[model samples]
Target chain A: QQQVKQSPQSLIVQKGGISIINCAYENTAFDYFPWYQQFPGKGPALLIAIRPDVSEKKEGRFTISFNKSAKQFSLHIMDSQPGDSATYFCAAITGNQFYFGTGTSLTVIP
Target chain B: SQTIHQWPATLVQPVGSPLSLECTVEGTSNPNLYWYRQAAGRGLQLLFYSVGIGQISSEVPQNLSASRPQDRQFILSSKKLLLSDSGFYLCAWSMLAGFYNEQFFGPGTRLTVL
Candidate 1:
């Protein structure tokens, strides 16, 4: 079974628009949630992360909104740029293991 | 600062051939290591993980196996490669301080089995 589920297999946005990708998990044991960005032929890099204690966290143009009761979290990218075109993945960590969402391919058109 | 490395960034092997992929971490000790495989434009599938030397955990039952020979060295091996084994392999490590920590990933190894 997929522990974490992400919506919108792909997304497209114009420059300066807002892009959002959402993920949901059933495991309440997850204590940490992180978002990763990956360019083609490269490793995924940590973009932003949030703990369950906080409902929201923002880093520059990237923001993570987490809802514990709903068991959901969403990543918001503001002012999307062409350079931001890449794949994004949301992951939940519990114990020493990580459960990842399938992934979302985001494209920003200039 | 710590960094991870994976050798033979790209590999192409015929079916039934033996395979070995190596991953190492520098400037860190006793890190929690992980191995993942990803199909084209797909999500990451956790294959194996290790928290300590000589300690390994398999998340999925497959033809592949993993070993942690040292504090920072992790290896993935397959006695006989299958066409289904073709994919991008990734190595990641996180601090052992607590259950929750950011994972650092290596560039990844692309394996093509004919």
Candidate 2:
């Protein structure tokens, strides 16, 4: 069973435009939600993370809007740049284990 | 400051061959270590995890096996490689502080089995 589900397997946006990716989880036990960005031939890096207590968290141009009641969270990138073109993964953690969503590939067209 | 290392960035092996991938963490002790496999353009699948030396937990059953001989060393081994085993292998480590910790990932190793 997939504990976390992500939508839009791929995305494309023009430079300076807004890019969004969303994820949903069924496990209420999940308390920590983190987003990771991965470039080709490299390891995924920790982009931003949010705890369930917060409704939203923003870091620079990246923002994570989390809805506790809906069991959903979304990543928003403002002023998307070509350098931001990569794969994004949303993960949820419960206890010591993590459940990941099947990544979303984003392309920022310059 | 902590860093993770994975060896043999790339590997190509014939079917039925033996395989081994190594991962190590530096600048930290008693970390929670994990192994994951990602297929081409796919999500990561958790393979194994360990919280201490000689303690390994397997999430999936297959030809693959993992061992933690040292506090910071984790090894993935397969007695006989299969074509289905071709994928990118990743090693991650997180502090044993609690559940709120974020995992640090290594560069990963790409394995191709013919």
lDDT tens digits by residue: candidate 1, A1-110: 99999988999999999999999999899999999999999999999999999999999999999999999999999999999999999999886768889999999999
C-alpha TM-score for every candidate: 0.97, 0.97
Q: Please, what are the lDDT tens digits per residue for candidate 1 over residues B1-114?
A: 899999889999999999999999999889999999999999898999999999999999999999999999999999999999999999999984864598889999999999
Worst 10 residues of 2 chain B by lDDT: B95-104
- List, residue by residue over A17-102, the lDDT tens digit for candidate 2: 99999999988999899999999888889999999999999999999999999999999999999999999999998778788889
By summed lDDT, the worst window of 10 consecutive residues in model 2 chain A runs over A92-101
Docking class of 2: medium
Off by over 4 Å in 2: none
Show pairs that collide, candidate 1.
none
Question: Distance (Å) between predicted and true CA of A9, model 1?
Answer: 0.7
Per-prediction DockQ scores? 0.85, 0.79
